[model samples]
Target: MRLLAAVDLGEGLESVVESARFLQEGLSIPAELLHVVPTPYFEALGRRFPHLRPGLEEALSQVEKEVQKTLADTGLRARVLRGFPAQVVAGEALKSRLVLLGQRGTGTLEALARGGLARYLLHRGEVPVLLLPRALKAVRRIAVGLDDSPASLSAFRVAEAWGRALGAEVFGLHLVSGQGGCCFPTYLDPETLGLADVLARAKAHLESLLKATGVVEVSKGDEELDLLRLAKAREADLLVLGSKAKSTWRHRLGRMVEVLSSQSSMPLLVVPEATVW
Candidate 1:
């Protein structure tokens, strides 16, 4: 598979480079390096202010040179392109299997609050986008957070495929929130279950799900924190999670998802839970 990684020369540029290297070595996919120059206004500002422009240009040139040097050093081929970052990267994504980017950028709080290019791409881009965490060292295994939803199953399949391809361990994780709100718990109440009995039954259900998948390394926890902790404990290379069910555009931008998205530190492969594909 071919992958396109956008290197913005922002704060996480080095991490992006390292991730590209890892993807090349692990997935055996050809990675193309893309650099997006902002629109003409920003470009013109840098051009008109000769002294100011030189330093910025020089720094970016250095990054480009370093990227090329690293690719050559590792015997990987790379290409550079200039345009609006999100648009260019999204366009490139249409021609490739996956896209990669850093978790955040080097822009001001206002710009970042507005959402970085990576966030934009995650919401709108067609292909799967991998947002590299800031602290990744090496990817040894992949973990899929599974639920009873079709989207979760899709993510699990993708994680399994990637794990097999990379010769990495595949882990199935199911988080059972003790709060009695979701559908699963409601269904269990009909069977005359107490809280403790409900958790036991949930564990058994998760076990059945894992048995169906034939993945031996299955883990279940009661809290999101516990799931993340288990992933870290296992030194997982990737974490796959399902997005919420479909809603209207306004509801989609609600607070819960925003908070959850802000908290994730690993590369979150979010698959729409209601997606048919």
Candidate 2:
């Protein structure tokens, strides 16, 4: 398996390296560090003043050197690809099993642009994308969103790999319907099913799903807020969510993951049902 990292030579460089180490420490996988070079905007000056070209070359060389130094101690290979950074990341993500990118992205334009490069890459890339925040290390605590769906089960499987790799503990949270006294007539409604029965069913499903792993710690709550609260309260480094690339429904993936992708304070790791790892 290939673990591709979108390495930035700036403040978040450590987070990029941290991700590479996280994947490599457990699985002896092939890892690649990608740096995208944006085309110069001042192209007209290059023709008018030929001397300007050499300075651009020098800047690129300096950037390459900086990236090399940042990854000197870490066993990561750096590859500089030339193109628009967002497009490059999206395109190369196809060849990778997992893409590790720093939050908020890089470059003045992308930084200044609305939503930033990270947001664009998340929407564009089909592969599982991990958005690493600054100053985070190994996945010590992981919280997974749970449901009876196969996609959620697949997410739990990926979480097992992460948990074993990091030597961490795993917890799960399932949202019960009709929380906050607003009762909808859906099948998931706790008011309709009775809280006790709903919880019992949830526990039974979790026991059956995680029987082999011996990870029986899970809770069924009333809302997604409960999962978010657990994530923050436990100081979790990663929040794993299940997303299906193509659903039978009219829309692609629903609004939940999309909202979390934009608003989450903690790092979000998405595992699509079709993803192998």
Top candidate by TM-score? 2
Alpha-carbon lDDT, every model? 0.61, 0.67
**Which residue pairs clash in candidate 2?**
none
Clashes (candidate 1): 0
lDDT of 1 by residue, 90-140 (tens): 787778777776765334573365356656655662566676657345656
lDDT for model 2: 0.67
Worst 10 residues of 1 by lDDT: 251-260
Worst ten in a row by lDDT for model 2: 180-189
Q: Where does candidate 1 stray beyond 4 Å?
A: 42-75, 104-114, 135-137, 182-187, 203-226, 244-260, 272-277
**Model 1, position 114: C-alpha lDDT score:** 30
